[model samples]
Target chain A: MSRQTPLNAAHRKLGARMVDFAGWDMPVQYTSVIAEHEAVRTAAGLFDVSHMGEIEFHGPGALAAVNGLLTNDLSRCADGQALYAGLLNDEGGFVDDVVAYRFSAERILVCVNASNREKDFAWMTARARGCTPVDRSDEFAQLALQGPKAAAILQRLTPVQLSGVGTYRFTEGAVAGVDCIIARTGYTGEDGFELYCAPVRAEALWNALLAAGAANGLKPAGLGARDSLRTEMKYALYGNDIDDAHTPLEAGLGWIVKLDKQDFVGKAALERQKAAGVPRRLVGFELTGAGIARHGYPVLKDGQRVGEVTSGTLGPSVKKAIGIGYVPAAHSAEGSTFDVEIRGRPVAARVVKTPFWKRG
Target chain B: MGNYPGSLKYTKDHEWARAEGSRYVIGITDHAQAELGEVVFVDLPEVGKQVTAGKPFGAAESTKAASDLFAPVTGKVVKANEALKADPSALNSDPYGAGWLVELEPTDGDTSHLMDADSYVKLLG
Candidate 1:
């Protein structure tokens, strides 16, 4: 069954086109993908990200319990700060990606994708060991206020002194007469904030922010806009770009893996793989022929099957067809030559640099 | 509602064809362009190529999705819009005007295999 976000009613009222995304009925677009994508790029865009999972871990054992749960060192995360980390299994394969925020030394909240919520909660609960893990996904909603003008728009509705919130930093503040957690982070490669608050108040806060950002061209953006924005940056989606079968090293996310850190799930295998270096690596490419490369299209290096296109699109930002795929490490360098087998034809494509486009 | 120029013949696949004398200019419809949303890259059909009715001549991809541009009529491609090589968004800007994909010489003058603008618009629903 498809789930609905708390802001579903609000999205409907705005005439958003909705679709089933990973079992959740989410808005894919409001006005249009290009318009919404530009709204976030040029100005500010509000997103109903309430479908994302938010879980709270409290009590004394929270710190130790979460440390073992995630690959990143939670000890490095101070109070009122956030860290992007991955949850891995014993094989060093990623189970899910999340933003871990420390409310205090004894409390932490991890926000994950909606599809991974139940599985993540079950995994955490089975090994609760000493802490109390609460599934707050059903109790809270998340909204991403993204773009260059997002900070100014959100500052008007909240008294949180937004200037002080650095990147990846979060604060407990009040907006729309309700307490909220504002995190200075977003999927879009822009300056923005992700606000977490009570589920019941989602519609009210969404509407209030829309009213405040009206003058700034803030449209209530949706998943369609979000996908394009992130794709422009070559940001990987969970299932499309990375999954449990693939290790972080192969997914081009080796930067997130800290081999020297304390042992976590999948640590040993990752350490060995890191020492030997990855055999296959993920890289981005641009289509050169008369076809739009899509997911599952076989990737070829000199007429040989080397990999397949994982995620691809004609990016709205750069106005070019860009996609990511795994290839042999030797062919992973920028400007390498490769052929994308689109529709059973070897379309000439070059291994361009990842993030086919970047913000100026 | 999207723009449906009264002068152009449209295909159910969202491609619009306008016959200019013996040559025909073809491209995606404004409704199709708006549906695709912010076309960035347009895969233009090669000139002098043989195309069949309902066969995908090429594609125009936007952030939202990539849509195949099917040939409205069976013809031999005479020309392709080269401007879209650097600026494919001309399709989104003017799908019927400067955004014309391929100019073809139709195999037949009788409208045998394509739908009209009104019929195509009704097919969208």
Candidate 2:
């Protein structure tokens, strides 16, 4: 049986179409995927991101233990700061991509993909030396309020001055009388806050936010809009885009990998790969003709299969079929043309610089 | 459960056939459209193309997944909905009306195979 989130009943009340997402019975869309997606880009939208896992680590050895496992350097991260990091296998391929929040010198919290929760906790626990890695997935309920007007809608509840919170910054405060860890972070390429609260208080907080934002046009978005919005921004979804078979470097996430850091899990393999040069590179493309290129669709160059699409959609904001995939390093440059085989038909497409839709 | 027009016939694959003299107006059932979410693209077979009963003639793509559109009866495609080619969301908004996929001139076929509205509703359960 698929697990249900704290707001599952609320979603059903709103007439959300539910789907089994990574073992969780989650809302895929409340209205339509395009409508919900456009709402996030234009005004504001809410998301029940409670399915995402939160793993905590605390102790004197927390920094050292976490720094050894992640590809990004945690030593430079100050309290109230968060940084995107990659957890890689010994062979330099990504096990999962995570957002590591530094609560203090001895405490840290990592938000991970829901599907990789158990596996990630076990992986980190086995490698941790002095610090204890705790699986706290069930303890927290996460909600995301995203878009240009997100702050205005959320400001009505919390006493904390949101203007002081910058991107990747967070603070502990009460929203609508419920204690929460309000963080300025989001998967969609929009300005937003992720509110992490106790599971028991989720329903109250959800209803309060909806009531407050109802006038400003904040609709309850679901996993469908979340996926499309992230795709438009070219953010890698752990399973579909980045997995054990692909390294962060090849996925165009080299900026997040700090090779200069000392003794991380995948450092050796990454160093060798960097020196040898990456054979393949992830690239973004837009369909020139017709049809959407879906995940696992064959990408062809000169009628020969060259790569495969990892993530794609007929982006609501962009109003075009766009996708990201891997190709030979030689053909990975912007403006290179390719054909994606959709339903046995080769539709012409061209490589383009991604984050297809950007807000002014 | 979604609305199933009593005047139409349904296939197990969730397509509906509305008899219009010699030609039948074909579209996906309301239940199928709801399950598919927002239809981003509706790829239909070209006009005059031969379609066999129970065979996939085209596909309907949503943000979540792609579902094949199966022919309800052996027929020759007389007209494909060109409007849906531009705006496929019609399938979600009005599956029984503007979302009609194709108009086909059906060949000699067994009428007993297709389920009526009551039977289709029962099968859905």
Candidate 3:
């Protein structure tokens, strides 16, 4: 059996449809995916994201030690700042994508995907030359409050000024007497806060926040809504849209890779891949036929397979069958035509921008 | 609406099969569609295509996931839902009515392998 989060009882109480996602028994949806998806896009939605992994790196050389482990330069990171970065193997394959939060010059917390917890923590510990890496994934719980009114909703409950935290920044404060790490980062494209608190105090804080935001139309969200929300914004989900086989350059995540930094894992390999030019690039498209494009669907050009969709689903907000996939870099141009094989028939599609849906 | 209809037989895979003279109309159970979320696409099997009981003939895509549209009883496809070709949300609106995936001429007259609404509801719980 997979592990259960602290919100498991609460999810079951809300009539959630439970599913095993990456070894966590989590709720996929409560009522409907479309309604929950629209709620987060237009209004507010609460997500139980305690299943994510959190590792604390500390010591005198913590900054340099952790910086060498990540592709992004940590020197640019200041207290209350967060950086989106990736960890890579020496061969340049992706280890995992993470969010690094710098609390002080000697302290940083890296939030990684839950499924990669053990592997990521091991990689960091094996390379800890002058610092300590602690696996604190189980010591905390997190909730994501997302939408346009997130800040307004959260401000009433917390004494701290909510507007002070900029994008990719965090504030360490108290909420309902609990030490909370409020970060302005989220998988969904909307402005939001990821609230982290003690594992023992998680349920109480969740109840407090939900109670505060109830009348404001902040409904509880689940993985189903989360998937649709991220898909609409074209955010990559590990294992589906990204994996160890793809490089940062091919995955269109080159922005997170810092080549100017000193020798880091995969630095030389990434440089070679960057210089050689990537053959396949991740691209987004909208299916033009009677069917929705989905993962594993073959993309064909004149009956020859060019690539397969990595992630595909209907965009509830945009009302379109949008999908993202890896295609030949030559066919990655906007408006380029291709066909996705759907149940034997070649469904027409066109390469568009990354996000098929945008919030107004 | 609570479960697969009583008179209709069901497959463990979730499709409901109802006998109509020499043919059977096949679609997913209300439970199936609800679990799959809002249907966005339905891949219909071509008319005259042969299918076996408990085998996949086509697929359905929804906001939640991709579900296989299984043939409840062995038959030859006679009619496929053409309206769903462009808009699959029709299934969510009326899964028992317009969302009927296909009509097939069954090779056998007996539909013993499927379940009625009462049994299907119990299976869901």
Candidate 4:
């Protein structure tokens, strides 16, 4: 049986179409993917992201233990700051991409993908030097309120000053009479906040947010819009875009990998790979001809198969068919031509600058 | 459960064929469109192309994935929907009407294997 989130019934009440996503019975769309995608781009959209896993480290050694596992330099972050980082295996490939929130030297929380919850906890616990990793996935239900109007809608319900919480910064406060960890972060490439609250208070918080934001065109979005929104921003989805086999350098995520930092799990292997140079790199492309490119579709150069697409979709905001794939460094340049084998036909495609949709 | 027009014949693959004189109007069912989410592109077979029963003739691309469109009866394409190229979301908004995929001139006119609305609804359950 698939696991259900705290707001599963609420989604059903909103007439959402449910699907099994990474073993969780989740809402894929409440109306249409395009509508939800546009809603987030123009107004605001709410999402039940409760399935995301949370791991906690508490002790005087928490900061060092958590920082040692991540590729990003977490020690640079001050209290109440959150940073995106990669948890790589010993071979320099990703275990999972994660967001670490530094509440203090004694308390840190890492938010991980739902599918990697059990595996990530075990990996961290085994390698942790001084502190035991605690799996807190089921303790909190997460909700994301995202878009241009997100601040206005969220400010109405929370006592915490929304403007004071800058991007990637968080503060613990009460929202709509419920205690929550209000983090100014999101995956949709929008100005928003992720509210993490107790599971028992999820329904009330969800209803309150919906009621407060209803006038501002806040719609209850689902996983469908979330996927497309992130795709437009060139954000990598675990398993689809980044995985255990592809290192951060090849995935166009070198910015997050601080190789100069103290010894991490994959430091040695990454050092060697960096010296050898990255052979293949991930690139963004748009179809020049008919047909939408999809994941697992063959990418061809001069009619010969060279690579495969990792994640693709017809971008709603951009109004074009766009995709990301891994290609040899020689072919991973801007304006390089390629063919995405759609069905049995080769449709023309061209490499382009990333983040298909840019905020104006 | 979704809207399954009673007058049309349905296939287990979720396609609907409406008999129109010697040609059959083809379109995906409402249930199929909803399950596929928003249809971003519909790849229909060109006019004069031959399509065989139980075979893929085109595809419907959604924001999430691509689903192949299978032919319900062996036929030759007489006319393919041109409107879908400009606004594919018509497939999600009006799957049975404006979203009609193609008009096929059947070689044998055989649709004995296809199910009616009742049977198709039962299959969905």
The model with the greatest lDDT is: 4
Pairs with backbone N, CA or C atoms under 3 Å apart (clashes), candidate 3? B10-B115
lDDT of 4 by residue, A1-360 (tens): 999999999999999989999899999999988899899999999999999999999999999999899999989999999999999999999999999999998999999999999999999999988899899999999999999999999999988999999999999999999999999999999899999999999999999999999999999999999999999999999998899999999999999999888889988888899999988888999999998888889999898999889999999999899999998889999999899999989999999998999987
Ranking by lDDT: 4, 2, 3, 1
**DockQ pick, better of 3 and 4:** 4
Tens-place lDDT digits, model 2, residues A217-284: 89999999999999999999999999998999899999999987868888899999999999888888
In candidate 3, what are the lDDT values of residues A104-158, reduced to their tens digit?
8799999999899999999999876688799999998999999887888889889
Per-model DockQ against the true two-chain complex = 0.49, 0.69, 0.77, 0.84
Better of 2 and 3 by lDDT: 2
Q: Is the docking of candidate 4 incorrect, acceptable, medium or high quality?
A: high
On residues B1-125, what C-alpha lDDT tens digit does candidate 1 reach at each position? Answer: 88887788877778888879987788888888777766777776678888888888777776656677898888899998899978887887877888889899988665655677678778887
Ranking by DockQ: 4, 3, 2, 1
User: What fraction of native interface contacts does model 3 preserve?
Assistant: 0.88
Predicted chain A of candidate 1: TM-score = 0.97
How big a share of the true inter-chain contacts is recovered in candidate 4?
0.84
State the displacement of the C-alpha of residue A159, model 3, in Å, after optimal TM-score superposition.
1.1
Can you give the lDDT of residue A203 in candidate 2? 94
Candidate 1 backbone overlaps, count: 1
- At residue A153, candidate 4 shows an lDDT of 93
Give candidate 4 regions above 4 Å deviation: none
Which consecutive 10 residues in model 2 chain A have the weakest lDDT in total?
A351-360
Q: After superposition, how far is residue B3 of candidate 4 from its true place, in Å?
A: 3.6
Candidate 3 TM-score versus the reference:
0.95
